[model samples]
Target chain A: MIDSIKYKIQICCGTMCYIMGGAELHLLNDHLPSNLKDKVSIEGIPCIGKCDTKEKHHPCVKINGEELNNATSQKIVKQLLTLENNDLL
Target chain B: MTYYNNAVITKHELLVRLIQLLDTNKLLDDIDRIPLEMRPRTNSPIRCCVHKDRAVIKYKLMALLGFNIADEQHELTPLKEYAEQALEGYTQNGNFLTVVDEACSSCVQVNYTVSNLCQGCEGRPCQVNCPKDAIMVLNGKANIDHQKCVNCGICQKACPFHAIAYLPVPCEESCPVKAIRKNADGIEEIDFDKCIHCGKCMTACPFGAISEKSQILNLFNNIKHKKEKTVAMVAPAILSQFKASSAQILNSIKAVGFDEVMEVAEGANMTTDHETNELLERLNSGATFMTTSCCPSYIEFSEKHAPELKPFISDTPSPMAYTAMLAKKRFPEHKAVFIGPCLAKRTEVYQNQNIDYVITTEELGAVFAALKFDLVKTDDSPIVSKVVRPESRGYAASGGVTNAIKTILSSEHNITTELIDGIDKKSIRLLRSLPNKKVTDASFYEVMACDGGCINGPVNVSPLKVSQNKLKKAIQEIQSEEAAV
Candidate 1:
């Protein structure tokens, strides 16, 4: 079996997101399945430097490539489902 | 974007970067260039210019390195100098909280302003309720003369349309003990004697002027000295934090150079058992009511705001203290560093001879990142399961202490428990009211300054609900694993 997951998820660990919801999102590392774990490279970035831009709702996350503002644990988990269920990786 | 992202995360990322540099032995050469490189001249300015932003970052790095700004005067010395001073083994002071005076917004201290929403009504109740006659209607709107205003706040109540608003300085309004007040220069200063070190103001400040003095460099230096084994005492609240299993977290901690990870919950089990016995003895011995002193901030509150209740507080050392004592006892050659989500734990450990250091979950997260330990790829927490009872594990949440005490105290004792989930002005007042010598009907009061206890502590990087769920799952897994035996 071979698994090559190329997802690079960067969650904003910036203070605004930290205070708003980024702190909660840091827990994302503990929830993903082990199979998906090998594929996804998750990191808490200093910040994407986009906080408060366009009055953005924070605890933002970049999944694969697209940034999702106002992200929650459930939303992130849902996005990870596809990557996790795949055994082919 | 708001400066908050830059204000808060910039400091943390910078600290992590410093640690990463140190891990790679590049600290001395590359550290100074961090702010400069991050805010390069070509980049649009965060402040008036990149140079100004870099200047603020320098003072911030100083604080992060556990040194206060050379105090209200003298141009800042270079980051290299502070790094040298830290390496020269300047021990940290008891004053753990410090304010960057330059960052202070020096916001005007005023209360109950009449806004444009103020209806220029003929009734003029704002004027009528103003005892100082501070209110005057002009330009078809109510205006408050700041000099004449006593801040009585009567006009706020008098306004029918709620046009009058109360503007509170973030740091001043959030301090439960009123320890922070502005100096003549308008920069906020903390009265250390009154300050509880709860760190509410740290999160409340928009300017991020408030900061905890760092001890990470000191810890690394301690490890460098090789005086003793570096024992990591993991708090009960830490089990499910950061989405890492207890095994992974423990191994990751070991991966960071800790000789071993001792469950603070093991000490908590002892604490819970000992505290319960103390409560039963106190209640049976005809004490009217006893308070749990496990929370250092609660102890500070009792000593400062409610000295009358000092006699009622249990003399038992807190879980952190007890764990440090136990850790020291078990391994005489060990230097215990408590890892928890509490900021007050810093103040608590500074006085404790047994505890060598106090690092928060946020700080530990930085260290983990600096070392680049990926829990997703690492093994689960290498902890021996069932080493701690499930009840003691409940120490992470509010009411957990009372529940643990209740498990030990017989129902025949007829103990009435009062649980205070959060401490604020109102709760402090309520605590003060207990000493009236009036007809009282309580055996124990469990007070957690932070709502949801240590899980919701000031510096915990995880969400409470998520942490709680993980805690619940971990406890169940422990119980079931034992059942499998």
Candidate 2:
């Protein structure tokens, strides 16, 4: 069951994002609960170009292609929990 | 690790906006709109009101424009006038720091206050511990007498109820030299003679009241006008700053309008060689001990606070100084810019003739944001050098200097070394006491003002642990590549 379900988490490694708190989001793996450990895969991607938009939220993250702005470790984990709950149902 | 608080975010936002305006040649025309734009009427106020918030932003922009708040000739002077003056080469009088009085929270004087939890207990330790008899039992609670209290913090510790609270001004507490204090208006003021420009106060202020005068606009103006060939001499600490590789970051900096990029680590090699010789010479000549003079803030501290230690400071030039010299010899017509995570370097540049400007790592991030350079996607521009030592690259972390010198002097002599990781009140006292102590154990002393060295500098972007891990990995990779060759 763990092998069948995997969530994709792409953390922005852009300069603006990295400085604005994206760097800490890279440590989301360490922060994941035991239940969600094998349920998610994290990768760092280059700038997603959201910094130039009218709504300026930096250090962005994308979980399963859903954009998360002003990303933090706890916020990402909370989103992951919801995603995992929906997928299990 | 530095906290990404709202103050830091606002500072970066202002920098990016100002640089963006300068890029499109609309800075002078739209400079005044920045305060209003950042604090529109619709948005809730960050301070007391929108007007106060806008006023603070305006003063912060003035500092970003390289003008001190004290430089304003009139109350209604627009930011565009400051921008105009900056473009016209108005000198900043070598002052790198300024206080945004509008933003200053005017924190109350540092003192101990007895909270309601104070029980006026049977032990009465608070009354007993008062050196000045400042503590008294009022009704059923303990009270501190403001008139007699010296703020020694004895009663705060003696209270069994743990009710006494010590309130401190963060900036004053962070300063090593006691350089900043509350003025008559309660706003903080820095004594230039006492300040070594370590920038601790700038980082410690929760309100972001202290600001460094930025040279970003002046640099942008030069690059845009093609006034002179601009060469960026990046410090070794930069390798740990970004997530991308060193080559990619260098290329990205080139993309930011620098004509040439030179690694200051190359100059660190020169420092190692000269310092090794100086240490050997001093040791052989029967001198007690010698300290490394690489840290600009440490050097300034020795000059202003510890004058007697001057004779023991090594005469070897810092990596920045050597790199700027090499830059001048190679690019005779270029204006050399030393890019690093240091505020004291601005003061260092004022004394050194070869270097023309200094920019912190935070300002560099703003430049990248304004230009919208994708760092990882940028083309790799590897440094072209005959010999690049891994030891020189290690100079970004604490004890790296001693390790480099040890590698060279290991076989010849068994020299003892001591490391002063960071400068603070306790470290200052130790440093001052060093001269009086006889028969010291160490022959070499390495002093870094910022704990964990330049990678953990006040203006650094990345976390200290992240930087340390990255730097270790990068150095190991360099060692392996050298081994393969």
Query: For every model in order, what is the number of clashing pairs?
Result: 8, 0
* Candidate with the greatest lDDT versus the true structure: 2
Record all residue pairs in model 2 with backbone atoms less than 3 Å apart, i.e. clashing: none
Best model per DockQ: 2
Tens-digit per-residue lDDT, B153-175, candidate 2: 88888887889898878889899
lDDT per residue (tens digit) for residues A1-89 in model 2 = 34644788998888878766776676687889999887788888999987762377888998989999988888988988887788779
After the best TM-score superposition of candidate 2, give how far the Cα of residue B159 lies from its true spot, in angstroms: 3.8
Could you give the C-alpha RMSD of every candidate to the true structure, in order shown?
7.0, 2.6
Q: What is candidate 2's fraction of native contacts?
A: 0.45
Clashing pairs in 1: A17-A22, A30-B243, B246-B381, B247-B380, B247-B381, B247-B382, B248-B380, B248-B381
Q: Which window of ten consecutive residues has the lowest lDDT sum in model 2 chain B?
A: B380-389
- Give candidate 1 regions above 4 Å deviation: A1-22, A26-89, B1-7, B38-52, B70-73, B88-90, B114-129, B135-143, B157-163, B221-228, B384-386
